[model samples]
Target: MALPSADQTGNMAEMEMQWAVKAMHHAETYMQLLKAVGGKNFKLTPIDDELYSDFKRNFPDLNIAVLNDDDFKTDMAKAKWREFINKYENRVTDFNFGSLLRIDCTGDYSEDNTMFVMRTQFYCIEIARNKEGLNDSHHS
Candidate 1:
């Protein structure tokens, strides 16, 4: 398939890349917080326990320390994630928005390891990472 040119894809300013830069910063900030407070003490919210519980309940196969980009991208995974995220849709702000997530909790985001995911899905995985101290390394 031919790649779409900027013209064919419409104004670049109106593209996801524009907002993606901002989203990257947000993700980085969250990572910084994890480094600062130590992942074990970093909470995504007051109900961190419930969020972590639901995450494990729904995704027993997923590895929170090293995420697979396909986990949420594959059709089968999407359905399960959607159902799990729906439980927090009303409470979590912008829970369904696209956000960048790092594949590994022990490293910084990079071109090869970052993937787009729903904000709440990010929350689920990240909450688990923090709880497990997976991203608590000084360099993370």
Candidate 2:
């Protein structure tokens, strides 16, 4: 096997960086859509409602209604999340692949309130978070 030339390696790194930027842009766009629709008060489209139901069914033990739920920190949650990610691996667009997901919609869009999560997982949580009562604390 031959080693990649320095220029080739540099190009690969640059391409990866561009992809990261694009992903961040997409995330920002998603946030904008959420805000435009009224953030936590936004009514989820039917597709999002179905996804939310699936999330509830799959992770029944967790309080999905809680803002920035701490259940994700548990070992069981991690295992279930891995399974959840795998289940939707081929279905979700941009499928996470170690992408940062913003947890708190009202907070600054930074690493502090975000964590690496699968794309579907992001939708599930955000939809749940945007529910009327669940996210009122943040807005209030």
Candidate 3:
């Protein structure tokens, strides 16, 4: 495969960095929000209850209480997420664009455990987690 020019490589790096910063900021803001108002009381939207139920219905095997990549790394998962993510595409901008998600929610979002996922996937999982008080200990 042809390699990118130096300028292209530089631009790619900058873009990646920008994505990371923005994604991390999203996670940080969520943590702060959770801290500001206990996770159980925090709602990402007026439809949080519906979102939580939908997520569970879509991924019955997913253990939001404790996260792991196994539930989301299979071919079936890719197809499942593709369908699940598309359900909100019209309502949420950049719904399928990549966002960083911590595989282990009990800790911070870091390169070590982070996985790239669609923005809506992040919201779906996170909103449910927060509502369930599973992500209450992030410490912002």
Candidate models: Cα lDDT each: 0.79, 0.64, 0.76
lDDT of 2 by residue, 5-124 (tens): 987777576778887887688677766665555555564344667777788898766544433545665788778787876766666665555455665555645767766566667778
Question: Which is better, 1 or 2, measured by lDDT?
Answer: 1
Q: Which stretches of candidate 1 lie over 4 Å from their true place?
A: 1-12
Q: Tens-digit lDDT track for model 3 on 1-140?
A: 99889877775767888987888888778767766776777666556677678888887778766567766778988888888878887776678878777777787666787787888888788887776667777534
**Alpha carbon lDDT at 46, candidate 1:** 69
Q: What TM-score does structure 3 among the candidates reach?
A: 0.78
lDDT of 1 by residue, 1-140 (tens): 99988778786765667688779888889867766777676577767898888888878878787887678778998888888888887888888888888887777778888888888888888888777767768533
**Residue 29 Cα positional deviation in candidate 1, in Å, after optimal superposition:** 0.9
Ranking by TM-score: 1, 3, 2
Q: Which numbered prediction scores highest in lDDT against the true structure?
A: 1
Instruction: Give the clash total for candidate 2.
Output: 0
TM-score of 2: 0.64
The candidate with the higher TM-score, 1 or 3, is: 1
Higher-scoring candidate on TM-score, 2 or 3: 3
For model 2, give the 10-residue run with minimal summed lDDT.
131-140
All predictions: root-mean-square deviation over Cα? 5.6, 5.1, 4.6
Taking the candidates one at a time, how many backbone clashes does each contain? 0, 0, 0
TM-score of 1: 0.82
